[model samples]
Target: MSGRAAAEKSGAMTGANEFKLTQGPEDSVSAVKFSPSSAQFLLVSSWDCTVRLFDVSANSMRMKYQHLAPVLDCAFYDPAHAWSGGLDNQLKTHDLNTDQDTIVGTHDAPIRCVEYCPEVNVMVTGSWDMSVRLWDPRTPCNAGTFTQPEKVYTLSVAVYTLAVFQLSVSVFQLSVSVFQLSGCVSAECLVRLALVMLTRCVCFQGYVLSSIEGRVAVEYLDPSLEVQKKKYAFKCHRLKENGIEQVFPVNAISFHSVHNTFATGGSDGFVNIWDPFNKKRLCQFHRYPTSIASLAFSTDGSLLAIASSYMQEQGDVSHPADAVFIRQVTDAETKPK
Candidate 1:
């Protein structure tokens, strides 16, 4: 990190400290992702039915993209060109450069997650309709689809030094290319008619899936039996009450851009950073007053944007209001705690 950038990252806050963004979404903001190419830029998706672009340094919303319904998740193909999926059951690409929005795909039910793997050169979208589809940016038509055995809620994708990754594949190829990770679960809305899986994230060589059951499942890509052999699962985001274990749904996960590390947030009202390489927690944040709906690490690994918001059954008053926090993360903080 450059001196100026590092100063902006940490400034005078040596101990646990975070800077609040200016004006934030009026409604619960469920997702906060830093731009892939720059740490100063970020995108926020919210129940307010809008996706706003912001300059992290300025803390100002520079642009707003509206959808017919609440946006569940989003991914940037580039700084200007990105994809968003929402309750409208539509996946649309919003081009910041031209300010043009194009609807490229539709789902039988609402789309739950959207991800882009640059190395593999593909975009994946998962929906409640029990399907995940892959698309080639070169064309609007879906290049492939993965029909899950159960209703799908969330997913993620990663790339490695494989010869190539293709969506259309034989049984053998699918055994290698198919990755079924977890998704995001919002804690703000009522859970009466909804089953939630809100977010997932692509880790180093594979992906991490977080569930309402308070578990994080780590699995890798194919082609290497050893990598797959290292796959494992663990319990997290849980609390004990009256000698009984009460589990909270995992709401979001964000990988450190440079640290080979990742963070998981849940309704337990905490964000835990982990070094999966060592199978240990680097740090745990306990300042949030409510469930953590979303998390994203900046491109340089110097900053993390956290959205602590309400996402539960309606009329719940345990927590109210929504806000975003930008914290400076350093090597010292990543030390085992």
Candidate 2:
């Protein structure tokens, strides 16, 4: 379907204003991130081996840069700089102001996630090599590398805290580990959310982890046994057909910066907002043409950028073209009742 048609379908379902970008990545869009300070600019990384910065307010691609291989993830270090890594096994920093690119470092395996932690003033990259490496954004040097129990599938930052999902799909295992990147250069595991299933994506609003089995865990950042008791898991994105149950992986998640509520996107092509405090779903947007690969809420929580792309989680198959939909969100859709 065309971008406009998809937007119409989505807008009708949630009653939220929506539009499609005039241009999008050539291949599957791996990630969509809004700037830390402003919502007008969005950073997108794709399997096309390029990262593009889009001026969402104007619906135009402002700048783009290429990588040797597919770019898996990208994050805005600040308004002027972006950090990205992917199949090339290399980490790169791009100066948005000058449009210059520099190779920072390399990982043994493909990098899956890139995140900037402002509180600690550090850049973090997670990889399939089973390690999380820290880089000093100012100096452009590797500060430290910490090993994980399994391959790092996703990483989320909440203040000085970093939440990492160590996943092993073959055995259906997952470890939700939290690291405090404060005083020391090396990271220390503050807490583990217990061994679960294969985790496809995670977002921090008190550290939320979603698995491939259509289950999501909401846990608190505080490691105290009492606060841990408040943590719970719920099943979603599952359908029953002909008495058989089919579960889709929750591929992406983003939290509303203002409301503290969150949205989850799944391979089922659906996105839903939830009130974690109330354990209720606020609303579910209309399904897209294909899988929902990534999601990002603008800084002030007035906008949400959704990437509908094919993840190939079921292996290579026919699917719709990749697209990014920018929706004007409201308190009714994001704010908890």
Error of 2 at 75 (Å): 0.2
Q: What is the lDDT of every predicted structure here?
A: 0.69, 0.88
After superposing candidate 2 on the true structure, give the runs of residues whose Cα lies further than 4 Å from its correct spot.
1-16, 169-173, 223-225
Best model per lDDT:
2
Deviation (Å) of 164 in candidate 1: 19
Indicate the TM-score of model 1: 0.77
User: How far off is model 1, as Cα RMSD?
Assistant: 8.6
Report how far off residue 67 is in candidate 2 (Å): 0.6
